[model samples]
Target: MQKGSFIGIDFGTTNTSVVRVFNDEHGYKTVNLGEGGDYPFSSIVAIPRQNGGSLKFGRDIKNHREELSSDYEIFTSMKSFLGTNKEFKVGDHRYSATEITTLFLKYIKDYISRTHPDVDLSKAGLSFPVDFSPEARRELRTAAENAGIKVNSFLSESTAAYFANRKAGQAFSKVMVLDWGGGTFDISILELKKNSITETAVFGERVGGDDIDFALAKRVHAEIIKKSEVYNPVAFEDMNLASKDYLISWCEKAKIEISNTEDDYESAIYNYGMYGTKSITVSVNLFNGVVEPIIKSRIRKAVDAALGRANLKPASIDAIVIVGGSSNLASYEEAITNIFKDSQVILPDKPQWSTAEGAALMQIIGGNFKLNNSLGLYLSDGSIFPILKEGEHGVGSVIETLSFSLTEDTQDAHFNFANEDGVMFERATIPTKGYLNEIIRLSARIDDDQIARIQLYNNSMGDLQHSKPTNVEVNKLTFYYDISGLK
Candidate 1:
């Protein structure tokens, strides 16, 4: 651990990991914090029942699971609701998703500070999903800042994973990153060149490992009730909150066990309090059956959609890189291999930590910034005039000037900002009077900050080349960028 080095924080839905990358004589190196036992700890927080009791996080919540729904108010998957209006009510305090996330991150910062006293946690690169909205990115950044951490930049999880793999000597011309974590499934089609990596297409869904865990838990609960010897066994839905939460936890563990075991069947036994003890045999076939409708179908469609958006076919992909915790499942490998039979499928070492490691690597290598969505204008004929096409420019000023004549007398010139997909997300207006054939110059540029700045110059008022801008409007569209030089 060195001072002034940038750390990478993969603040995930179900788990969070942090890695510090710094340059030495040998080159870039990374050291995993929270080492020994809990390197990639659980993404969970629990509020104590008592007023003075300290809030619990990560392995603390796991070690005290039975007391969660009863003794403490538990919050998980806070990242999924980053930009939403979701709130958690605990006692007289209501916590927003951002607030809860801040608490969790502060805990992480403190934990690292205590473990590695000499390391600087001031600046770090954070990883987010490609499909995360601008609002979500803003909220995530705010949370980190609130937690005493300065965000250096944001990197997409898929891109981070690619960087990690590439550093490990896994190279490909065009690659698809299948990132199936605990809370989301993201597919990214990227074009890799010697100096840069371009994201061609990205698709994501909220469904993930948590969904599968719940589905499997319900299935197992049904089986348990059927074989119960009690006079009147309660259904899984009717069960108490603690019981249901405990069952879900058990099911998650069982799912992992089933995936890791080589035996034909793995037995999971649990006690449902008054409902008596029950045991169910789980096999690969049974696990697949429970998750087929939930996991397999969705990923296939998402992958296809990503490919279609990129205007690429299955054969066009040179390799498929699998990253994230849930990607370790055998079913995920089978499903991906089945679809991209001709493409090479690679599962990197320690797939769960790949994203965080990649984020750390990005801080070292530097990256280019690109627009995630197109910025353009709407024409009078219901068509779009692209001012700055998405993914065309990076990290500099791009100016586009177009001249248009007024068809008739108009007091105001309306500019509707649209994307290449024909969706108008914003509009701007310039107040100027002009008659027929009077030319107006519209100047548009995406600055280094990714803000679309548009200005209008009315030739009728003064010299067309020397006149000042009549009006300027800024459209806060979404833009994606990676970390720049850190040395």
Candidate 2:
């Protein structure tokens, strides 16, 4: 482990992974850091319901599954809430998602400390979905720093996975990467150059493996309750959230088991809180019936959207690569195959490790930064001119030369930042300082902390509430952001 080199981290929704790259005169290689030499540790945290309970993670939390109904609180799917800036409350404590992420990262740091005593991880190459905004990135950086690791670079997960699969002398020119994880599904269209892979476009949605688990669990729970003569279906619906979570976890395990086998899979939950002795018989066809629609619809929209933005058709795609833990579903491959009949779809052997490895490979190859959203100024004619294009700038760099001048002498001149849909994220009034067509230089950037900071630069007026711009060097207003989130 080099002192200054970046430690690749896939801080995932369902599981987290860590890797350190060793690069020298020979070349670059990776050393995995996980229990049993595998690249995954459960990404969950458990807190006791009592006022003074210690935080526990990984297997320790799983050991307390039976106590979930009354004794503890479990936090999962926090990664899905990134950039939403929401908070969770228990007793008098309210923890923002960013703070929880920082704690989880700190736990990861401690694990690395214990498992590989010789290695010291400081700087990291953390992977985020392309949809995470500049604000989300900043929040992640803050969390990373709090966890004792400085985020040297933020690589989009799908793009990193693409690089992980790109081989020397490969014939493919264009590839689409699908990352269907527990809490989110991200898709990226990439252009493979003579020697490197470049991400052309990426799109994401909130649907993932967790949704399937919940849906299946609900069905299985209903079946269990129906077997109980005393508890009616309506009454069973009133079961506590903890019971729901427990059932969902059991269903998720069954889902994973079914993905590997070629036949029907059966799982049973014995002696639940209210329902005693209930079992589920899930065949590939049955499981597919529940999840296929979501997989098909989302994959279609994401793949089509990416391909459309990249100006390529289905036939033009050279390969479709699947990455992430939940991508092992047979339906995922089937749906993709149905879409691109002529193209080949690939599922890498170590899908879980691809993104983290790609982050390292991306760093070693000097990859560029890809902004997940578009920042632009809206024109008077309902049109927009873009600034800080995604995939164009280097990571953590600022866009300083994007200056705009007023074309009209109206009082409602607005500067906004948003996605391709033109919905405004945050807006500001251009303080002309009492001049017509004043040059207002706007330097907007996603700082190293992943916070989106837009500085309105002008020699004009200042910061007067109702008065013409007076004398403030910078305004104090910024949008709420940490990682990017999509509707």
lDDT per model vs. reference = 0.75, 0.69
Model 1 lDDT tens row, 263-324: 44545555576666666776677778887776556888888888887889999998999998
Q: Model 1 compared with the native: what TM-score?
A: 0.82
Clashes of each: 0, 14
lDDT of 1 at 456: 76
What's the TM-score of every candidate structure? 0.82, 0.84
Which ranges of candidate 1 are over 4 A from the true structure?
1-4, 35-38, 167-171, 229-235, 262-274, 365-367, 371-374, 389-487
**What is the lDDT, from 0 to 100, of the residue 80 in candidate 1?**
92
Displacement of residue 11 (Cα, Å) in model 1 is 1.0
- Cα-based lDDT at residue 470, candidate 2: 20
